[model samples]
Target: MPSASLSVKGRISMINFNTMNLRQENNIRRRFIMKKAARFLVVILSMMFLWGCELALIGIGASVGVGTYKFIEGKLERPYPIELQKAWDATNTALTNLQISVSGSLLEGAKGNIEGVRKDGVTVYISLKDEGQKVTTIGVRVGTFGDRIEADLVHKEIAAAAGL
Candidate 1:
């Protein structure tokens, strides 16, 4: 038997209403929706991966699980194998040894922020965070726009002071 058809707006729509059961029509609609949803999910995941790649290129995103030294967001950061207190002391000693006058300091629980002013009048900020037992993360930034060389020097000084 020929399937019934209707002409609407110069387009012919075929309807096998008499041949296809309601369950079959419903299954077809469900499959279409599922396919569309899967396509959308793939697009979203691809966009996320691209964004992560951009961040990595700009030195702002690194694999957190690796615990490696990384330059991120205009700062240098590294995970040190030392306690929080020890890290804090090392940072302070480093600043002093470099003749950088500390302008401000804040220590709250497992996190610390130390701000200092160099002899050249450039400001520097050092941040320390406790990552785990006997593990601490240190970050160094110099001036408002970030001086990479100065930041690197500060990090090296901290490591030397800590004997790490």
Candidate 2:
């Protein structure tokens, strides 16, 4: 009888130990899963936040008649619904009107660049690419880095000159 009692007690203790280990293991796995979920959520939210400005710009451009543009690196680019030749001529006129002295220029069949210097000695570069018929995209940059105000001014002048 005594031996039987000791064996039963040992079995009961083993069962308790096993149950405790299982509980602890389950808790660790739950915590790991929770941590992963939290990290994923943070990454998703951060991406959305980063894209907020781009989305807003798209919406604004869509609302306006001017198509969407992308500011890449230091260049602010825009598209005009005009022929490449028209756009090129308008660019020159715009720079001349803006009092930016043309330093150098190049015009190929589908790509071209116009470099000039403002009175303030800030270098301005305007690049043109033919997208399709009556569609030309222009990328403008001011100085070595970039100047949004100057770039925008250039774009605005180009648009006006192109009758866009």
Candidate 3:
């Protein structure tokens, strides 16, 4: 009788030890998952904050129908009071007048991108954005590294062509 009691006590202790170990493992796994999730959230929040700061600093709001011209992100952007199709046609004519051959053209909905290359191998890119209500914006970039003067000249030609 004494031996049987000892054996039962030993089995109960073993079961208790196994249950404790399982609980500990579950706690550790839960903590690990929580830590990983926290880290991921921190990274996502940081990216969002950085993007917001960039938009603020660049004054994206100031460009809407302001009809102002400025250089941003290596490109010259100008807002105009014109329709999308008209602006796109004028831009193509302006490039042609400047002796730039249109190499590629992409138009989707109310936006367009036109790429041209000069005889001297200088490339120019023109982007048009129509924000509805007769508010259109034009962005110009010249060459790979961007030439501000050339871009301004192209913009002037485009404005003339558009009768703006």
Q: Which candidate achieves the best TM-score against the true structure?
A: 2
Residue-wise C-alpha lDDT for candidate 3, range 17-66, written one tens digit per residue: 99999999999999999999999999999988787463443335434443
For model 1, residues 6-44, the per-residue Cα lDDT tens digits are 356324223444346676888999999999999999999
- TM-score, cand. 2: 0.62
Ranking by lDDT: 3, 2, 1
Tell me the TM-score of model 3: 0.60
lDDT of 2 by residue, 1-164 (tens): 35635577789999999999999999999999999999999999988888847555434322433456777888998877777899999999999999999999999999999999999899999999987756677999998998887898889899899877
List ranges where model 1 is wrong by over 4 Å: 1-67
After TM-score superposition, the amount by which residue 143's alpha carbon in candidate 1 deviates from its true location, in angstroms, is: 1.1
- Candidate 3 regions exceeding 4 Å error are 1-67
TM-score of every candidate? 0.60, 0.62, 0.60
- Model 1 vs. true fold: TM: 0.60
